[model samples]
Target chain A: MEISTTKQFDLHRRMVRIRLFEEAAGRLAEANRLPGFLHLYVGEEAVASGVCGALNDDDHITSTHRGHGHLVAKGGDFNRMMAELMGKATGYCKGKGGSMHISDTSLGMLGANGIVGAGSPIAVGAAFANRYRGRGQVAVAFFGDGSTNIGAFHEAANMACALHLPIVFACENNEYGEFTPRHKTMAITDIVDRAAGYGMPGVIVDGMDVIAVHEAAVEAVERARQGGGPSLIEAKTYRYYNHHGIQNLGLKYRPDEEVATWKQRDPIFTFEDRMIENGVATREKVDEIWAELRQDIETAIQFADDSPYPTPDQIMVDVYTKSSTTIGTKS
Target chain B: MTRTASIVGMIVNPNAGKDIRRLVTPATHTSDVTKVGIVRRAIVAAFESGASKVLLMPDNHRLAERASDRIKGDIEVLDMPLSGSRFDTIAAAHVFCQAQVGAVIALGGDGTSRDVAIGWPDAPLIAISTGTNNVFPSAIDGTSAGAAAAFVASGAVCLSVVARRSKKVVVKIDDRDKSLDDLALVDLAFINSMFVGARAVRDPHTVHAVISCVATPASTGLSSIAGRIHPVGRWETGGVFVRLGAGGRKVRVPLAPGSFTTMEIAEVRRLGEGEKISLSGKTVLAFDGERDLPVSAFGTVTAHIEATGPLLIDVEQTLVLAAQALMFDETARHISEGNHVY
Candidate 1:
């Protein structure tokens, strides 16, 4: 999975965009400007950036509550997302879906679901659709390690295997599923082990390393698109912020030392250093990208501010496809 | 107006709504999975909306018996020949079709609806949510669901105008052998792209389905994936394999066991009114959720989509209209005369 110049640069830009977007959104959420529950994807940027980078526009991806990173990584407009978080009229869901439920079907990014392990079966269904039509498209479902234990996850995995649907079940094992340590909550250490029961390949990747994740995801996506069966990839990543709101320190859960230990392998710094070490990019270029991201974040903020609030009538819309305007856009 | 009136029959799956057993004996309730409560509510609502008679699908499950007891008006309990198996639901549906019921009101998830639909094609169908994976059932309340059914039964709701007709895929195995009713309604799944199976439950094998409408135009199920990429499903009706978990170099399709996790499809074909699906493999064919006959490796199957169908009425609307009619303080003729009201 050697990175081509175009792919590498695209990954770099997307990683930066996700990080910056979260940082901006985190600030607004802290200031109480943004409404509802906000789960920042500050540290897990590489995972989404890398995995989504391998997907084609026709490929499908389902997201979790902490889905802003996936949304940005999959080419969703930052302005509309920001507007949605701000409850503006121009948001992807017309302000109905905020931080947790952002969606853009045109981008093959299904809305982030609030339920755990909910997207797994849906992605399988989407993959089934692709295979049935003889299309080379694939579907990906991104969820947390905590979701592995849910019946939905097991059911979906088994179905995926039995059906041989083209799908990649990407589990971002962020250690804590809302304060509970991964070890204490479950008997299985590796979420990938669950994949064995379903009789599929389950690969573990360093979620902190963007290149590693990209390589692994690329294979899975290609296999899916080429009529191969589904695969489950468990990306071991860490979240910098608390489960919700501003980053809560410990909050009576994880130890300070454990947090510090994981922080030592910060994905962002590692990527930046790797870029320089490989002579692919310089510190100057990195700084320039950061500057550009800052400008983009500012523009998104303006868009959200200028965006209108959805009229009350809009609320009556979008609940069903009979009323949805985007129904006919699918191929 | 009398010519427009359609006689719609209603049936309920006893394993719908919240899992009440989860509160106490999590094992018992969660084990078999029942939608009886949802079925009961939908039936009651339908009866309240002037449904002359409703059919309650029988099962050994206490939920079905209890639900059957709850309906308001005169009701008929159709005893399914299958002792206590899940096939009882399908048998009950067949009975309703044999009764020449103009339409079918199905209460359950996609599986239940699929079962009833296969048994009674072009029969007006009103599906209400009561099962776990509910893509076909309407989320509307039981009262509304029953009302909609009543209106359809009484010839108030128009099929071509209000109800959207769904396409069914006809599948055949070999040159001449077994067959499938509608292969695309989550009926057939190709596991790991190798083995063919049924159902959409948990498994490692990939799923393959042949669909009539895939391009976001039909039901959002396993077939939607193919619709997005190839869009071939929109042009024709057939099965496509949606692969799931990774497997050998071969194109493996994941399928459910008996019904929930895998399906093996020997042949793929289109479905219409006159077309039939044939299977050639020694594989078993499960229609909807009920187990059907087995097809040998050389069996054949065929399917054809029936365009002209009965008008499906919404139970909800039917219930609402019935309530309104009751409030009119007059007879049926009086309500009919009041139709001129602005």
Candidate 2:
């Protein structure tokens, strides 16, 4: 997938943005500054960056619990994202949704769901709508390997294939399902095999390399957008932190050696090194990018801290209660 | 366990058949599932032939990990991080060389074998065909190839007599970095292009020249452009050199799957061992059908054939030698009274 130098720069920049954002959020969570659980996308940044790099600015995507990287790569505002994490009124959902539910309609990012496989149907539905409107917009559903076993995922695959919907099922196979190893819950080693039952073409790519992921995604996205029906892409990746937060719980779910091995293949650093070798950018440029993103995240944290909380009158503004009295509404 | 020759090294390329060529040509796409199945059969057969442990290259699809499921023997993955490029294969072969593995099984195309050769030139390789326009790999089944590999790895079948040491064409680019030095097992072609985009040489019109290590008659790909005119075999001491242009003899070559392109041949001849062929042009250097290093018009590249390559295992020959030694004889098995040496 012949990516120009400009696109290569964009890919690496987006990856660093995600890594920096996740690192800041992790620090906040560790310091007890954040309210809700933050599912950090630390080691799996390449999957989001590469998949989104192949997407158009107006293309739609449904994100999973570890969706911060997806939104950030899709051009989500840092200030609004940090505010949403702090539950401030200036957030993306006006403080109603935290990290897991953050979404920007302008960026065509559907809400990141807390449910494991719920994004599948939403992405499929969005693809159907896009096809109906004939705007040439493709929808990508980003989920984990564990979700491939879910009934919703299967149903979505079946419907997308049967209807020839313009959707791509992007599976970030991080080798675990929350606290459990994926092997314990699933029989198949490759999640791409699940797409075969629905007669959808499946592709497996290296999630640690942004170029590999972007190459595969470019083909799959093109295939879907050209009315070639849906395609499933499984990226073999790993998450650095525990599924929820940076603070390690007492429970040992995986081994240190495994974590150490994965850390050596850190997507952001590797891409920077690669870009330098390929003559795409200089080391100073890479360093500047990291510094800029770090400052941006810090500013975003301050913004979230300074923003006001939702007022009492706004408590029941977007929430539907269907009760006789409008709850939380002051006279 | 004491026979340091009990380990078999495996390199299964996940991206071999999955390339842009599939869209351009009617190439057979070898799904990761089918590759896993082939790996399973190969590893099991290696163990059955008395190999104690097997080491596999870790890939993105977890082909090694998946192939090792429920496998009784010690199926170890090389302790190395992946770069997700051709470097992964080279790194894995380097590890295998440091470990001094008995025999290595490569599951990919000519390009995959070439990568392994770069890491360990003296590797006892059993390269199985799993890519487009393959000439270095064999068409044998994984089971037989694995069994033969086990025989070689176990020192049961001697390499000196049964194995065929293949030939390779090494190219050194002057005015370029030392890393640009590369080799090809079958053929090295000069593609008339500036960038190595997509990696596959699809258009016959762009191929300017080819230098082949071993071009068997009736072969396909770049070698066939010369093979159809003058044949060369693995045991031969020399190579085939050809230049492509108009107003010359035209021959058909299957550059990809399900189709053929007739290429005009300007000149063809036998390239003797160590005979350096000079190439100076603005073109992409394609090693075994994969466009790798590019050359500028100011740089001069020299390519020559060498017998210093991998020791390719002869599956049928190794099995025949084993049968001759009563290793597969039922009478000998009965005489052993179920106290199997394996």
Give the top-scoring candidate (DockQ): 2
Query: Pick by lDDT: which candidate is best?
Result: 2
Candidates in order, interface RMSD in Å: 17.9, 4.9
- Full-model lDDT for every candidate: 0.63, 0.84
The DockQ assigned to candidate 1 is 0.01
For model 2, residues A44-66, the per-residue Cα lDDT tens digits are: 98899998999999999999999
TM-score of model number 2: 0.77
| CAPRI level of candidate 1 | incorrect
How high is the lDDT of residue B175 in model 1?
A: 30
Q: Local error of candidate 2 at B76, Å? A: 9.7
